[model samples]
Target: MLDQAQMRYFEGNYQACFELCLKGLEVVDENLKEKFVELAALSALKLEIPQALEFCAQSYHWHKNSYFWTLNLAKALIIQQNYAEAIKLLNAFMGVENPLKLEYLHALLRAYKGQNTYNEVENIYAILLKNNPNDLQLWLEFGEYFEFIPKKALGIYQDCYFFINQKLQALEKNTPKIEVLQTFAQDSLTARFNMQKTQKTLIENPEILNLKNFVNTILTQRIAESYLRIFESPLQEAQKAAQILYSVQDKNLQNAEFWFIFAHALEYIKDYAQAEQAYRYIFAIPNAPKNIANTAAFHLAYLLMRQERFKEGLEFYENRLAFAKNTTFSQEYYQIAKNAFLQDSKVFTNKEIFVYCEQGFGDTLMFSRVFEVLCKIAKKVLFAPQSALYPLFSAKLSKENCFANLEILDRIPQDFDFALPLTSLPLFLGLDTLEKIVTLKTPIISPTNKRKSRKIKRIGFFWHTDFALKENNTRNFSLEFFLNFLLELENVKLVSLQVGDFVLPECVENAGVGFKDWLDTYKVMENLDGVVGIDSSPAHLALICGIPTLVILQPRFDWRFGLYEAPKAKFYGENAHLFVSNPNDFSTKNTIIEKLKSIF
Candidate 1:
């Protein structure tokens, strides 16, 4: 029993092992005290109990020579915010043979950070980085250290950047042999397979051509990381990182990691078309890593979703469930989404269907357009929307039932035989092509309070989006930047449609008697002559309301916004025009001003 308990502890069944250890402690032999103490401490730490420090202290006392006990004790101390004790414990290992490796060093770094010992932290970081130049954690720590001691780390940071740039240059030089490119073109496994079709399309597709140019020029991850650390704003840093990557050559198309990194960066910048191609390019190669292929397929599905290409997208999305481990979504939720499955909606005839809302508020609204179609097919339909969206959706979807609370996920209606996410509707309904999406009936949800206006054109603007999304930050601006341009316009009256963190300073005329629910927001949008904002909910709202909207796009705008000079936007309809901002080099202000100037 004791041996089994120890095995469970090593296997990371921490909570289960903790219970076993507690039960074992009552009857264990005297010689097993040290082992029990170590297991108890380790499990308690993993389970995050207050007794962890006490248990860890006892383990170290009983087994002083065991590095596991020492490291666990130090980690517990750090967790308990006992920086002094942790530093003291970590410092003791510094002089020992093969000391301060991996967890010990990681613990020591946390201790140093807790104690604000910048110099010692840098020394330790440098040591680990030198030992393992390719260690991502070490590189990330080095990058973080600059953020930690911004002013004092300037000279050191410059030297680090120079070294990293040189490393990137060397990595870039590792191009495939001439014959490899020839093989890729005609006889390589990828070229000989279905990828040959994609390769041929890429050669002629203008969108692919633009992306190929951008993808071929960017720097590697390490070089971009090193370069971006110089910028204070995370948004600017990501923008610069994307630009750096956009200028480098992917000389080694055969490199899997290289494609993954490049694809990831492209996604971050909202270059979905290119990102899709890059991800697909990875799978075309034989012997592609299972994990990478699955992840790429998952992201490719999302890229397609963003473009409203749901049928094929959901197929790929579902395919990724096998590899969907350690994600933010709960296991239960994952099982539900994974198990719900995709099929023709006609199969749900004479059946009850539960439609679940996934993703953000914007996504729910954008996809809710399909609920009416769903209700027409299923005999009984129950819709679960985000709590905040319930007020508007319930009002609009009153003919059909709607549940806002998440607790509904626990008991879903008793008779519902089929389930699907709101986003997956397009797929199951067979709305596969872009032409179908463009012609799909516009959603109708009447807003409660409509503004009665005069001759002056009502130009509405929303400046900020979710701050946590780093890519959205690139599209965001100081309200002042837009205000200055709008203030210069003589024929239009500016209205602030922005809410939450973005509504500060109250510079523009507030629309109506405040806003409530998506209905009120849409009503406000309905009265506008035009709307300007990033690729956020408000932009989607404006499109749904059939307002003339000019969407300000970052270099990597969402695929639904379509390419530059696209005749019509899939999501925003024919009334929308796009103005993509150049992040690293040019100003988007003049372009925006010109668009605003032409609006009247």
Candidate 2:
């Protein structure tokens, strides 16, 4: 029996070995106490916890002062996650009267803290403080622990800092007067107390000076680490910072650095009025860097554009062109000149409209609509980057529409009539009323197989190209959203009348009806039931085609969506239906779906 028990124990068969040992103890009691203790420890190690605990109890009963058996029981309780019971057993083993009892007490306190028993932790801390009243580190730790616990421990941190300061003051060889020390401590305490109170009040009303100072200190000290992070803060927080900086009395703080932040903050809030004012402040500053001034001028023009003051905005661009040196505003100046021409009734008597390619192939293609209009007034010459657009334009436009156009070259035309950039069509044509322009009556194409079988509704689809803009940041909707809507609708044979390289959605693609050029796209648009897309060239093309178009506008976009009033008459003309959503509205998907349903 002994041999079997030994074998089982060696093989780590704890239950079997424990059972055999118990049976052996029942049969014979010679030298059994030591054997029981060893078996209990082994069983506990094997995690046969209940049996091990019972054995420990028996061993402790036989030898009342056996600390080893008591410790084994405590360890078993700890392994079972009964920390409180384990602490009690450890305390009993340490015998409260022992000199090393404090060590075990500290361990119990740590165990309570590890379990997040804050009250127990505080009680133990209180005991330790009572025992060692002069330990400064302990006092500081206690103060730190109490920092977040409301009014109950409000003075602890002050007291800790005061005591530490006093100790340092005492160590000085030139001892200050008792009155000075007392005054300093009192002042320190008052300052700390007032800081907490002011912080609360500032959070409640951020415009206050004390709160502003606190925020400025944090922002300025951490600016190198947190400049971008500060820009990314909530618009309200950034606005508060901007306001504080605006009100600063320091001349150095009122420079472009401060105004740039202020401008961005106002921009984020869509406070274009205030943002324009801030940008102007930066522009007015003497000796401002060329890039900064140019940016300010650009943004100011953008604001004016948003407000539909296109003439005034173009003037700002012209001013930048005149004054700002070595900047991109020169290109922008060309754009503004064209915009001014398009929007106003300013006659271009022999003026050369210089059409240089600005953004993309599709963009150049769309803006080429200006050539037809310009040909009526000015000696038109296109300075484009793409050779492909040249042939496309030649094929699409007639002899009268084509001016003495030269190839894309590095130098400007020495002898020309008044010049206007291509994208400035909106300005040159005075984009006011749809009824004024002559509409094309010719059918874009003959009936195809897809159009012959079904009663076609002439639905137009434009899944805007991802690469059409700098990033997807500019385009508003995804392919799936449009495709899903098209797939569910009936009685509508959708046509891809989209201009640009923007991929058509799967439904449009699978229908095998897509256009590759602006001519073909506009031709297809002329036959569509209606045009549907986020802000894109097709929307413009449809408007020009005199067809009904539904434009899904993003929040706070260009004034083309008609921010000033419903029917945004100044931008998209009266015929366009503008579908817009607010920033706070989370139901954009549902709104789009409903709008599509109504159109279908």
Candidate 3:
């Protein structure tokens, strides 16, 4: 019975082998228990069940080689999504070198992903790929990790294409030799080498053929995406990407991911009609990944929202709930957002509403304007702002109105009748529609009589913004760009709004006082004639204070700013000016300098 089970396992009949192993185990002696248990566990794993974990645990108890059994147990736990146990077991084996390290590392990759530990997943991928560049599954996993960032994924896929072709060429050249070497080997050692060589050839090894097909499919999808990264102009980028993709025969025909990228490129350029058709193409595909389909629907919703088709937009945005993985400040907030049961603004009459700040400080600053509107309707309003913005909110609102106490450590206050995130307020208030949004009041604050040296014609400049984002880093130009331009503008003093320590030429003066408090930052802006910077907290603060501001934008600017260059962003009021720079054109510097001179 045991011999039959071994034969079935070798023949790849996992279900038959699993049943036969169970029968073999029923009458197997103690000496043979470990072998039967390992086989049973492997078969159960192939069947995808908790039965593997039980059998692997039994194998671990009876096996002489503890490390092998522990590794198998970890693999079983990882398959079952019991990542904590898998992670613990993997960590135990991390420093200790063993022959099974490769298996341990791969299991660790899945465990990290299960725990949402993306940085570690990337780290492990880098290590694995460096050791074995021909590992197609490793490349696939790497590309999948960047699903949100398609351009990065495309780059990885291209690398995989290069590697796969190299491997295929090598395999093809060696195939004729493989058969001859196997038939004419002189001895057991020579025969063994020829057999290993045969197994490595693509013609003999079916796994390589399967991987080669997968690589071709991924390579086709990435061609369109890789082109989109060329940020010349919106229309130009989209057209270039589309044209390059269409040039490839059969590349665009049946590829869902290709259509998805092509649609986004069109969307970026505001070709709504073509973009919508491209998205619908992806949705029409019966075999498209659900997460990707939901994302397409999400983008379709965004298009409607951008076009001020509010009713249609809201429906699509809600459809994204099927895949929208929202991370809020708390589990309660996440649940509230996911459920979205009470999104109506009109429901909160004479009730205490707590509006917790979410996302970045720029978003919070932009949405803080809605607090006054909330105070008007709600019986009482509690403003729970980010730690950095707490001082700003306290100064803006009365002490009684602001809730500085962090409920993160304690229970969510049961006193509030309704709680909503700052970003969600626009949706609930029916302020998303263009007409309603146009009439929405711009927030203006009265100067607190705080001024820094009463500098009447001073222009505050900052080049450092959100360096953590790759896009934001591109927007941050050198200080030399400003210094070269400002050399002629002797009348206007340039005050650096950048917080970090750096040596600025005598041409520009640092603001000196670091903004430890929001009030200090407010006073500095109040004194300046205008603010000049990329998108940052200071820029947002300056706009809110009604300071004349000139914002330098990247070619692909943040969605808050319109896609194309305009004199101003209407929502932030007339004092704010926006200039979009073409990354390919160096002359944009002169244009920016001219705008800065005009604004100042």
Candidate 4:
């Protein structure tokens, strides 16, 4: 039964595995209890919380003193959002003298940290340090825990600094690989310690030149490892580094590496104009590698696009494609060029449309608005990824179009007038402004009813779950945050207009009118008084539907949303509002709340 449950879990039958674990827990022998614990842990990981919790309770009852069972119970409780109980169980497990006690303690500390129980977390660290006095990493971890707490950080910093310094001093003159690994571990801890300390200090004193120099030295010494650390640290450090580098008299200091760092710093500071100039400088280097040049051009083009200088951006993208080393980058450049052309009227006419699929199905769906315009203007439209999307497009667009793979393009039709990429339809259609092209006519809500809601303002909300390529997991705001925002609003009915396999919040799901299809979402959106979301298909759909839409954008967002030039995007013209958080400071939760309030 246990083997079958494990196999079912591996096969993605989470519901079946969860049920099996519950059935196994009924016969509570030692082996069955162990199996129940393992299956419960697996079920918790699979997000089947009810069954996980049930099995976990049975496991704890069978072996109350077992740390593994208690840990699994804690994990299941955490999954069920019973953090208080989870923390209690974790604390019980932490009292054990086993090797895994430290790991359990760490998990408890993390749980307490997530709940903002800073004192509890500090207590755990202090206890851990007393138990393992020789563990340098523990000292560093404690420092990291206090890094954001201004009042408590000083003591933590001093402890980590001393521990790491002592380890560094003890390093032998001739060390083996094992010793080197130990040294590296200490160095990493030290790096993190300095980074956090310097960040806190920089926040308080932005013009600390000496501290800036110290950070720069560390960054230069550990270039690769320090990149992410420096990049994510306080913006003031990068600004100070850029200022120090800019003030240097030596011409040799203006190398690709220096300029790239400077550009990154400027970008972090939201000085897009200066970042643009820095990228241009990199592009002008006499013997710059193709990859570097291509990158510079891409950034330059992206900045230009953000500034709404579509003509210049299109030119730069063309240059990028001409010299691009990687096929993927070249393809991306081509797609950008095509999209830029769709927005600019100057280059829309007499162009042959070449449609190549890029990114994901959702992106392709969002950009498919260009296809209708292309069919009307282009002499011939050639679509790639012919086998997959051809039938779909054919059903949507009942026109004579050529669909072929890249390899079969040798036999060009002689009478073709002009060729343009599919994404270039906006530029080709001469729709420079969103107001100029986007029709305000809302989609008909029902078969015989075209009336708007009279009592309440219909607000459409879309939360995206398709950011697979995004690095930061926090980019996807919790459903709790959205629910909090919705609960505070007045005279508004919040409708979930999201698509794909998004896990809707309990608040949203329990609101009674849950949708199961895109058609239903679209129909609801068509009658909305206003719409708001991140950069997703529904946001685009609301824009196309001519509803007033607000896009809550990330600070350093994708170039497609025009990140560099227009801080407030003009994507959907005056009807569309873009609200961006401060990149330097991540404490904009209140700012977002206030913005939503103002809108309401």
* Candidate 4 residue runs with Cα over 4 Å from true position: 1-257, 319-354, 359-373, 380-420, 424-451, 465-475, 497-507, 510-524, 527-529, 558-566, 582-600
- Candidate 3 Cα lDDT to native: 0.68
Q: All models: lDDT?
A: 0.64, 0.54, 0.68, 0.56
Q: Give all TM-scores, in the order shown.
A: 0.62, 0.47, 0.61, 0.48
Pairs that clash in candidate 1: 217-246, 217-247, 217-248, 218-245, 218-246, 218-247, 218-248, 219-245
**Best candidate, TM-score-wise?**
1
Candidate 3 residue pairs in clash (backbone atoms < 3 Å): none
Candidate order by TM-score, highest to lowest? 1, 3, 4, 2
Index of the highest-lDDT prediction = 3
Writing each residue's lDDT as its tens digit, candidate 2 over 1-600 gives: 667877888898877887777778777667664675567466664764655666666666766666555665655555566778877777775644555455555656655755678887788777776787556556656655654442334344344445445554554424322221212243476657764322211122222333235334323322211222222233444455455555552533435756665665566466777888888888778888777777677667766766656676655643444443342125555655655555765656456555555445544544454455555566545464344344444443433324444334344557554454445554556532333222322111221223334375667766565563432113555556666556666667667654444565444633214445555565565456677776666676566545667776544345444332342634334446767643233446666657765654
User: On residues 366-445, what C-alpha lDDT tens digit does candidate 1 reach at each position?
Assistant: 77666556656667667667665665554454332322211223234565566666666676666676656556543345
Candidate 3 positional error at 388, Å:
0.6
Clashes of each: 8, 19, 0, 16
lDDT of model 3 at residue 36? 79
RMSD to the native, candidate 3? Answer: 12.1
